[model samples]
Target: MKKLFFLPILFLLFACNGNAQKKSSDKAEEKFEVTKTEQEWKEELTEAEFQVLRKAATERPYSSELNDITEAGVFVCAACGNELYRSEHKFDSGTGWPSFDRAIEGGVAYGSDSKLGYQRNEVHCARCGGHLGHVFDDGPRETTGKRHCINGVAMDFIPDDTK
Candidate 1:
């Protein structure tokens, strides 16, 4: 009887083992269109941008001015100027990050991230393979129902010149 109780616990433990998690470096192994050496990237991007874009590190929430941006324009990758999210899709998620309902098609790539000890859909710039952010299912249901929670330091806002 005691063995039956331990069986479920053992199963849960094995299910959550580190081996089952996807390695974060898996995305790094893939080639991107705009490839640059670490030195080159370091020179072009600021410290905060390099850490988030190159190292896949998360920035402190609410630290980015992009979160409050409501103007019309597009957000592009800070590393390579790759077009990412359009202004029309941007929304306030109240999650302390710039949230968008969708990304420009073919502009971003998806990968599995288990760095948090759980599965998350990681977003990256397709042009440069720079880490952008994560996508979650919980978002505005009126639209795509996906929240692209991106790091502000990883992007730059280009306001519409016609406006």
Candidate 2:
């Protein structure tokens, strides 16, 4: 009898959380200027990239080549070529993902994520609305105090011009 009573409450809680995430995603998508069909995105991105960017799936940590890059460059959206973070802001968070203390102005947007049964700030391309990753408070305190934990699959590094 106790289990039965608690089951309905659990279901309602999870159900409401899912709907809230969906609505939040919808609102974020609506603000994006560059819209694409699912087929178009799939055709453009690789299977791994597609999973991370389109489906919000995370790539294996420390598996990204970008994790080792030390060149001064710009990190752009792999889906739309919008500059999101600069190399100067990049840091080794030791979490295996590319971590930036801050994102470029107007480059990315935040949305509430509850995929882990708790709220997280989701990071996505402002132009295309593709999922990049999540941001957390654990970062370099000298800077923004934000660990913009991003997926390398969602980014492309453009080397800086040595002029």
Candidate 3:
């Protein structure tokens, strides 16, 4: 009886470990259009920007000024200046970070993130492969019904001439 119980626990442990390893290895094989050395990226980006954009870290909620801006313009990747979310798609999801209903076509990519022990749809910069944030299904029903909760540190806002 003891041997049987131990076997099942061991199997469960190995199964969980294997899944984690597979996810990480698959992410490692991915390539982006704008690639750079870690040192080169560190030199170009500020410490905070590097953390969020390169290391997949989250910023403090409501800490970014971009959350307050309602101007008409575009939000682009800070790493590569690739156009991402447009002002028209942005909304106050009240999550502190800049939230968007949609991204500019083909400007962003999605990946799986289970870092927090649960599955999440990870968002990335398609041009540079920088981690932007996560997307959730809880959003406005009037539109795409997707909430793209993004870190402002990973992006730069460009106000339109009219704004």
Candidate 4:
């Protein structure tokens, strides 16, 4: 019985090791290098962007203009103007923050967040280490089971030309 248990535990350890190695490999492939200085970012972004992106400050709940915005456009990073979310994925989560069901491909990156003694999926700009938001697994089934909880100050909405 001890031998049997040992074998299963060894197999589980190997599986976990394999998964960890794969993730490190994946991060190495996807990791982006920041190429801008603080002054450059400050010149490019407004005071709000500096606070939310660089300082990792959270905006007040229910204080984002994008929460009620129902326009057809792309939301770009306020710091670097990297296209982050599209209008199609925007949704009302009633969470008092700008919520999105999806993200623009290659626009955002995910990492483990351990702040406040809780682990979460921390979403940041792919081009910059600017904090965009946190992602949750509970979302509408019609969409991906992902809810990107973002701050309004982190994004700049660009209305579609039709508007």
Task: Give the best candidate by TM-score.
Answer: 3
Q: What is the TM-score of each candidate against the true structure?
A: 0.85, 0.84, 0.87, 0.76
Query: Could you tell me the TM-score of candidate 2?
Result: 0.84
User: Predictions ranked by lDDT, top down?
Assistant: 1, 3, 2, 4
Error of 1 at 131 (Å): 0.3
Whose TM-score is higher: candidate 1's or candidate 3's?
Answer: 3
TM-score (C-alpha) between model 4 and the true structure: 0.76
- CA deviation > 4 Å runs, candidate 2: 1-29
Residue pairs that clash (backbone atoms under 3 angstroms), model 4:
none
The lDDT for every candidate, in the order shown, is 0.92, 0.90, 0.91, 0.82
Q: Higher TM-score: candidate 2 or 3?
A: 3
The whole-model C-alpha lDDT of candidate 4 against the native structure comes to 0.82
Models ranked on TM-score: 3, 1, 2, 4
Error of 2 at 27 (Å): 4.5
| Residue-by-residue lDDT tens digits, candidate 1, 29-53 | 8889999999999999999999999
Q: Between candidates 3 and 4, which one is better according to lDDT?
A: 3
Per-residue CA lDDT of model 3 for 56-161, tens digit only, reads 9999999999998898999999999999999999999989999999999999998888889888999999889999999999989999999999999999999999
- Cα lDDT, model 1, residue 151: 100
Candidates' RMSD to native: 5.5, 5.0, 3.5, 6.8
lDDT of 2 by residue, 83-133 (tens): 999999999999999999999999998887787877889999999999999
Backbone clashes in model 2, listed as residue pairs:
none
